[model samples]
Target: MDTLSKLFKNNIRQYGMIIALVVIMLLFEILTGGLLLKPINITNLILQNSYILVLAIGMVLIIITGHIDLSVGSIAAFVGAAAAIMMVDWGWPTWAAVVASLVVGGLIGAWQGFWVAYVRIPAFIVTLAGMLLFRGLTMIVLEGQSISPFPSGFQKISSGFIPDFGSFGTNMVAVVAGIILSVVYIINELRDRRAQLKYNFKVISQGMFLLKLILLVAVINVFTFMLASYSGIPNILILLFVLIVIYSFVMNKTVMGRHIYALGGNEKAAGLSGVKTKKVTFWVFVNMGVLAAISGLIFAARLNAATPRAGTNFELDAIAACFIGGASASGGIGTVFGAIIGGLVMGVLNNGMSLIGLGIDWQQGIKGLVLLLAVAFDIYNKNKRSV
Candidate 1:
């Protein structure tokens, strides 16, 4: 009981949001008469939320360094417009267009990174300027028109699904993959537990650990099953998964990650500790630019059009997801998994409200309320910890 209490207290934010997500899903499922979790809706939900999720991943890193980027939405829009022009107006090959778009995104990031890192400008001002600057550029590039009908191959970047060579009704491959992942998850959990014990670290009880594994495994299988029911797996979903895995690894296991956290926790101290604060901050923005570019492509591909307003309010959503996902406003604290969970919470809320015939105005109001409450919850936790 004591161990359980300690564990719960330690991870209350994560556990709380997860429970809230399940409750939200269930409530919507009941309200929408089962439409919320339908295989097709679930698939659409993922497709709709991919860009925000990608941006959230990058946003969390920036926030962790005690900074923010308001220009992501504009960056996404500008890059998408550029790519559209490359493919549509210039007749560039799809692959080359994509590469060029990502490069453009990187250059944009580097430009902002220079201002924020070297010039010692505040991130908010820098990104705000960038937001206005890039939004105008998007309109200028597209000449206030939307471009459409990308190559089918280019379209696949966002809308394609994994092929299932062997399936009966549902995708058997997805089910098998789910099973394999569950086994792997269990192995990883047990290994982690053993390592903690070997290090003489304080650990949860055996039963608690097992219960945690069981719940997570159930989630993995169920999530895959639902996706398998409609389409095996989306290409974007695969990309999101790969990204989550890579970023999570980078955050928890790498030196650069440590420097970022340190910089966020205390810029002066980090610099004194030989962290190269400017370099770290600069690189983080550069990474954000790349991710934002990637998100722009995903959005454009999903819509099959590049428009002037492609990424309206995207920066706000990404920032909101990070905060709701348990990222600290003060920096030096957040997780990739937490950011994903936060984005899903927003996604589920949007889907649920739309299905229940809620008006867009009300949806915005409710989402804003939810964001406020999540941040309030974080503050409460922070205060309690300090006490």
Candidate 2:
């Protein structure tokens, strides 16, 4: 019992944020008259927030390294415009166009990174400049017009659903995948617990561990059921899942990841400790650019068009998601899972408010309040701990 209490205290922020999310979800779910979690709505929720979630992933890493990228939204817009010009106007192959767009995104990242990392320009100034520069380029590329009617295959990147097969009228593929995922999660948790025990690390009691596993598994199965009832999992969802797994592993298990955290915690110390701060910072921006490009492509595909205004304010949303997800404003603290939870919190709010017939003005105001409160909560905890 004491062990469980200690575990809960140590992880209060994580558990508290999760509980907050659940409570907000429940509140909205009730207010929406069950419309918020309808099978179709659930699918739409994933689709609608997919791009933002992608941005949040990259942004979280950037924030972790004590930096920010205000240009991702603009970069995404530029890439989307570039993709549209290539595939629609120039008749390039969809695959080739995508490759080229990603390359362009990388190049853009490299450009900003050069100034920020090596030239000693602050990341804020560099990305802000990039934001303006790319937004202008997007307008020039599109000539203040929208490009549309991309190839059918290009559209599939965002709109396609995994095909269903096997017995039962439902999507057996989704069901099976859900079961496999649950088992894998359980195994991983158990393995981690065993490793902790071997290292003589403190861990939650067995009963609490079991309870956590059950709750997680139940949530997974319920979500899978929703998707199975619809048209199976979405291609974008698959992409999101893959990204989450990969980034989570990278941040939690890789040396580079630790270096980033160290850099964020104290750049001078990290550099003295043999961390290549410049290279890490440079690569971080480069990664951000690539992700922004991919997000741009997904956004463009979902809209079936590229417009000059595409990705406007996306940087704000991504930054907000990272902070709301438990990322520190001063950096050196965050998690990939936390970012997802934060994104979902925002996503659910958007969907729920829309369902309840709230106007955009009210929605924005309420979202701002929620973001403020989340950050305030984080600060309060930090201060309390210090005290």
Candidate 3:
């Protein structure tokens, strides 16, 4: 009982948001009269929020390092415009255009990074300037117009699904993939438990661990089943899953990750401890730029057009997701998985309200409230820890 209490208290924030997410879904499910969880609606939910999720993944890392990128929305818009121009106007292959756009994104990140790291400018100021700069560049590139009807292959990046092996009612691919993911998750958990035991680290009891594994596996399989019932797995979902796994691993297990946390915790202390604070900050923004570019491409493909005003208010969504997911406003604390949850929370809220005939005005007010409460929760936790 003591151990359970300790675990619950230690993970209240993590568990709290998760519980909140489930509750929100249930409330919406009840209100929407089952429309919220229908397979088709579920698929639409994923598709509509994929870009924000992408930005949140990258934005979490930035926040972890005690910085924010106000320019990501504009960067995404700019990259989408550049890619559209390459493919639509210059007649470049879709693959080449995408690669070039990503590189361009990296350069843009590097540009902002240089100012923040080397020049010691505040990230807020630098990225705020970038927001204006890139938004203008996006307009110039598109000549204040929308570009459309990209190549079929380019469009598939956002709208295509994994191939169905048969015309059967259920998609065998999704079902099989779910099983594989469940097995992988279980095996990974077991291995981690063994490692903890070897290191004399605190570990959950076998019963609880097993229960967790079972619950998580059930959820995973159920989610996949829903997808299978719809149009099978989306290609963009595969992209998101791969990115989450990779970023989660990188942040949790890498030396670079350690450096980032240390830097965010205290810059002077980290520098004295032999950390390259400038380099890490630079790289983090570069990564953000790349992710923004990918998100931009996906967004444009989804809309089948690139507009001058694309990506408006995107930075707010990404920033809100990070904070809502438990990233500290002051930094040095966050997780990739947490950011994903936050994005999903926003996604569900938007989808649910829209489904229930809510107006955009009310939706904005509610989202603002959610974000405020989340940050307040964080502050409460911080004060409690200090006490």
lDDT of 3 by residue, 215-290 (tens): 9999999999999999899999999999999998888899998998998899899999999999999999999999
Per-residue alpha-carbon lDDT of candidate 1 for residues 64-136, written as tens digits (9 for 90 to 100): 9999999999999999999999998899999999999999999999999999999999999999999999999
Each prediction's Cα lDDT score?
Answer: 0.95, 0.93, 0.94
| Pairs of residues clashing in candidate 2 | none
Error of 1 at 153 (Å): 0.6
Candidate 3 matches the true fold with a TM-score of: 0.98
Poorest 10 consecutive residues of model 2 by lDDT? 7-16
Q: Estimate each model's TM-score.
A: 0.98, 0.98, 0.98
Q: Which regions of candidate 3 fall more than 4 Å away from where they truly are?
A: none
Tell me the alpha-carbon RMSD of every candidate.
Answer: 0.9, 1.1, 0.9
Count of clashing residue pairs in every prediction:
0, 0, 0
**Shift of residue 382 alpha carbon in model 2, Å:** 1.4
Question: What lDDT is reached at residue 191 by model 1?
Answer: 91
Clashing pairs in 1: none
Q: After best superposition, candidate 2 residue 269: deviation in angstroms?
A: 0.4
